[model samples]
Target: MKTNPVIETLLSHRSIRKFKDQPLTEEQIQLLVESAQAASTSSFTQSYSIIGVDDPEIKKQLRIISANNQFYVEHNGFFFVFVADQYRNQLIGRDHHEDTSVLDTTQRLIVALGDASFAAQNMAVAAESIGLGICYIGSILNDINKTSELLQLPDHVYPLFGMAVGYPDQDPEKKPRLPHDVVYHRNHYNPQPSRDALDAYDQAVRRYYETRTGGTREETWTGQIARGLGNPYRKALKPFLEKQHLGLR
Candidate 1:
């Protein structure tokens, strides 16, 4: 059956947690970064940067900071740590003799985060198109202080997220998502869809997990969300971000 190019590419995408022990070619890495830069930027400001972790020692250190995710340390042929960077612009402002203290504000930090996320997703799609696998490690937020020091991040540059890329060694079952109505709203905002949509999605997820992972069935989506949200591992992020000089009050 024929499919829309975008839809077909997206349907083929999945998080790959396992990868073969092989490094990517220079040509492949160049194409990945180039495609990442092609993503849209807010107001054409492009307030972001990506640090490619090439050294094994550095990648090992980052793995510890990211809660010891062995997959992050060993699997990927390329590890790109996307950064929310305003220092580059601050330098530009300074060259023009303009004050850049505003770069420390929370609002500007949001802009950098938005830019970094967009670029990261673009690179992910581009890699997937070439039969590469991608996984995002939000766990990098676990130790912001250590990450800041390891990467030698400047005042206005913060690690937003990390991406692991390589050929897939395993094809994990695709996790189910809520129906479109739950996330996509019409002209006017509506919360009703979120209310019951999650319950139905929970069943879809449980069936997937039971057949794929052979894991115990999930009770409900609400319960799963509550379990994750209530964990202390998720709560430590605010203080961590503050320590890195991000989200300045």
Candidate 2:
């Protein structure tokens, strides 16, 4: 298959769990922030803010809050907390004597969330292209309330996920992805998947993990899904969002 450098880089993307103990230079950090800012925003609102945490004390607190139980946070050159922020827009409206409560609606919250997610992905791609590695710490949601408080976030701002970026210490093979046919629909939604197809996919995923872990892990994709979704996850998310003045509509 013919591919360019961008495609190749994306295809090789993997979550780096281990990173070299070296900090990123100021120039590199600036470039990453610039790349994130270059991402597209909803209606030009650009409702996202990034907090780069470098202080050892703050990073330690965040790692504990995340419950990620990983070394990436401690070793990563920079850990970024992406925040979905409508606060700036709300303040702008207030300055004009306009009611800003409308910004508390779920619709606006979604826009800010999308803006933050897009910015994170842009930075991730840029990092991969530059020979750096990244790992997203979604477990930060484990304690969103505490996370926000610790970050000293104001109203109209909510913590999304964090990214740990540094030089890779390990090389992992690319993991398998599901077939495109089931993922990409013609126009509308097509949700049905044949048992045989799913079984094949499950087997493929099992083999991938088994190989990756040197036979230590023999888990399947569907099994992981079952374990992940069977129980409640981050039940506090909704309440946390509401407290942040997001998704309150």
Candidate 3:
């Protein structure tokens, strides 16, 4: 099968959980930041900033707050927190002697989030291209107040997510993905695929799981989603989002 470089890079992507305790070179860090800045911004606002946290003590505290994942603090050499920020623009407005307080709208917040996410994904792809491992830490949202206090985020700025980067310690098998038709649509949106289509996908996922995990555990896509949604972690996301001054009326 013939493939382009971009397709090949994207197809082989996986989240690297384990990493070697090696520091990233200054050149590499600069390249990552440059690549992140190249991503398209919403209305050219570029409402995002990345915090590079290298302090061991701070990393340790973040590790505890981020689900007690010691790998984040002990293993990874560099940590980055991506923030959705309108604060910079607020300052721009202040310099121009204009009001910047009206940026508290839901639309503005979403735009900032979109900008941050685009930049993060760009940096992740760039890191992967250089044989570096990366894992996104969504669990940073688990304690919004503490995270905000630790980062000293101003109003109109929120930590969207975090990324831990280093050389891989181990390479796990690539997890299976849903069928293309399930996610891809034609001109317009379809309700969903037929039950038979979903069943075929479930069987494929089940087989993939059996082979990948050496028959130790089995799971279908629906079952996995159901299990995840059934947990208490699912309930707190919306309220937590609200507490962060996001997604409000």
Candidate 4:
């Protein structure tokens, strides 16, 4: 396969759950944020804000809010909460005496979400390139209201997710992904995917888990997806977003 240094880094990406006890230097933090800022934003709105959690007490609280399962939240070099924020733009519009009703629309919310995600991915790649390991903590959304309150977030701002970056203490095997044929289509959408390819991919994923867990886990990708979707989680997300004055339109 055609590759370069950047492609190698991207391909070798792994979630580093175990990080060394060392905290990140301020210089490293600045570089990571600069990389995030370099990501493309929608119409240059830059409708996102990154909150670096340095307070030990706050990290403990966040670990609790993450269902108390992800201890790495409080033990990383640094933690960041990427927020989908339109509050800044709202203030801008208010200062100019212009209508900011558009900021509350679902369209603007999507734009903010995309901007935040792009920024986070850029930071992740940059961190990896600098010999740091990172893991995305989406469980921060488990209790969005409590997270918002804990972080003291304001109206028109929502905490999308958290990220923990630090020096690696352990190396884990890369998780298997869906096959190319199942995800990539030529032109039109391929509603009917090849079952043979899917079956092979499922077995590969099952073996990956089995080997990773020493046979304790042997579930396939399809089974995992089915279990995840069997019951809807976070039903309060929509109401919570509306309460934040986002996606109200």
- Give the runs in model 4 whose Cα sits over 4 Å from its true position: none
| lDDT (10s digit) by residue, model 2, range 1-249 | 899999998989999988888999999999999999999999999999999999888788788877647768767978999999999998999899998988989999999999999999999999999999999998778888888877899988988999999999999877888777757788888879667777888999999888888999999888999998879878998987887788788
For model 4, the local distance difference test gives: 0.94
- The most accurate candidate by TM-score is 4
lDDT string, candidate 3, 55-77, tens digits: 88777777777878456554685
Query: Where does candidate 2 clash, by residue pair?
Result: none
When 1 and 2 are scored with lDDT, the better candidate is 2
TM-score of each: 0.90, 0.95, 0.89, 0.98
Candidate lDDT (C-alpha), each: 0.82, 0.89, 0.82, 0.94
**Clash pairs, model 1 backbone:** none
Model 2 RMSD, rounded to 1 decimal: 1.3
Residues 96-142, model 1: lDDT tens digits: 99987777779888888999999999999999998889989877777
How displaced is residue 93 in candidate 1, in Å? 1.3
Best by lDDT: 4
- Cα TM-score of candidate 2: 0.95
Model 4, backbone clash pairs (residues 3+ apart or across chains), number: 0
**Ten residues in a row with the worst lDDT in model 4?**
62-71
The residue pairs found clashing in candidate 3 are: none
